[model samples]
Target: MNNPEVYDIKAKLEAIHQDIKRLMEKSNQEYLDIMLANLKNDLINSLTSYVSDDIEHGLHRGMVDPCQMRETCKSRFTEFLENNTSLIGQENVSKNIIDEKRAELDEIRETAPFDKCDICFSEVNSLFEKQLNLISSRQIYSNTEKKQTEISSIPEELMVKSVLEPLSNKQRLQILKSMASETMTFTALSELTGLRGGNLLFHIQKLLESDLILQRHERGDYMITKKGYNLLLMLSNFLKFLEK
Candidate 1:
């Protein structure tokens, strides 16, 4: 028969092991959370700046009225979208955004734009706020020669398999969205998604393999990686734009 004291000691060891595992998992998750936040902020800043430059350029191009003559501000915004977005291979995304912007151009044409610089800037600021929210992708090197080169350098087959395959399942998407704000253990996830045992694990494994999530250790809590968070953020932005 097994000794009672030996069983007590083994139980203590197991509990201690679990405690250490939790601490390590927490530390790792905190780091990932911070990185994801930074990435999100970076995307916002870049997109905001992209539009701001165009606004400034448009203002500069506005012809000063000679003898208080009225002249309509020919929109650089629409022309900017038509020229710039086509280069990025985001044909559908660009088209949708352009259509929304086009709706506003009719209203904008009513104003004698250069008359009040402040009002022009203020109105354009509102637009900047609305449109920037629609674009949250990694435009890190966007519209630059670097991005043009990077686009062709990427392997088409591998990239498609990696991004599209993992995102194909409803449960896999749920698992990712669930862990966006916090890390989750296997049991907790199974409970949240109503999945069980190996079935739950199979989905988790796909995310892990795709670098979309990180497991603290074997049979440990799962945390979303920066790639995972960024992808979801971009998808959310694009889908919201598409829905309108």
Candidate 2:
């Protein structure tokens, strides 16, 4: 491919990239804040049940000892926090926040039969941890959206089969991506792809047949076409989906 082809593809893809940025600027805060509020309230309810056996019947006796019940309740709630089931961040729920929460919960504990139990609620705030390799999903709506995938449906004139078949090979795909910003000489291509002579020519020929790239002659510099660059951009967008 030549310098002109390289510039053409880069210019086109850069424009599309900006448009995608605008489309993905959706406000995720309102939804995230709502979820956070519901989560805290639900957690309070669950903790209340865990600490108290019978809220309606204060005069009734239960078989479970108070000490055992308190330890079990704390461990259960702490494990749930450590698990991160609701995507609540451990950092977001800090030490100070936990202490404040425990103090508040202790006050809530004094209501009715709950006051009879001597269980301290400190562990409720202290056991948050990273769970199941999940990260904070609060910014979920800020990622590449489902609509971005519509670009995959290429028209026949763009030579869909020819273009994608070449890109299917990792080395050929790399060769095209290497030409995104500038044309690459044969020697430079060989070094980047780690393939020399005839072996390198095989992948290069596939891209040429697809017209996804331009070359001066049999062994000249290579540059990506607009079609090729957009394919790279598509793959990049898809990868962003995987990351989310």
Candidate 3:
């Protein structure tokens, strides 16, 4: 029977186990060690639970698909993390640390090569939905408080000026409109806007200063941020109001 993917997954599982074991040993914190061990066990169970079933059904019948194996195991790991925040010790783990790690892992998953396995992809997607739910719930709580504080502390006049100044330029307006659809690189933006060199850089800087766009550090793609999307919605409403 074809089972190379199983073996490959087993090897990766062992590597992950060893990595956690080393971290646990190095930290020498009993609570942390216990947490890491629990995490490692969860990952093992997630990977191997489907192995026997797959063998019985003849799923891995062809050449080894490395991406499939890796993504499957990694998704399991992520799921464990999302579902088991209790693994974090009351004294040792900060919620901020967990949040940062989750954000980092999610960014990696987003940029990963597309997965062709529908089954594996579905599992990953479900886990992502769970993660998003958790994040949204947390953000709603925190942002409610944060928004109230900002509203009290920040001047409305200043906020209006900051927002309106960025929308003052016709060329910058065009750039923002295009970015609302999809991210573009510097060259793409230049071509789209027919602006280049210092002229393009000036507009991009203006958007950056306004926090309306985010630039990918490695790829240099400029994408609209949440603030930018909300601004666009507000612009639409304002235009409708004017029409009325």
Cα lDDT, all candidates: 0.68, 0.60, 0.66
Give the winner by TM-score: 1
A best-first ranking of the candidates according to their lDDT comes to 1, 3, 2
Cα RMSD to the true fold for all candidates:
19.2, 17.0, 27.3
Off by over 4 Å in 2: 1-160
Clashing pairs in 1: none
* TM agreement with the true structure for every prediction: 0.39, 0.36, 0.36
Model 3 lDDT tens row, 1-244: 4599889999999999999999988788878879988986675455344333332233233212666465465544454444434332222333565576568656645655555545444554454444344434434322355565776898777676668788889888889999988998899888988998999999989899889998988657899999998999999999999999
Off by over 4 Å in 1: 1-154
lDDT for each residue of candidate 2 in 1-244, tens digit (9 for 90 to 100): 9999999999999999988876665435666788988996776555445333321122122212445455455444444443344333332433354355446555644542554343233223222222221222332222323433554554665555676578778899889888999999988989998999999989988888887898866667788888788878988999999999
Residue 30 local lDDT, model 3: 76
1 versus 3: better lDDT goes to? 1
lDDT of 2 at 175: 91
> Candidate 3: global Cα-lDDT?
0.66
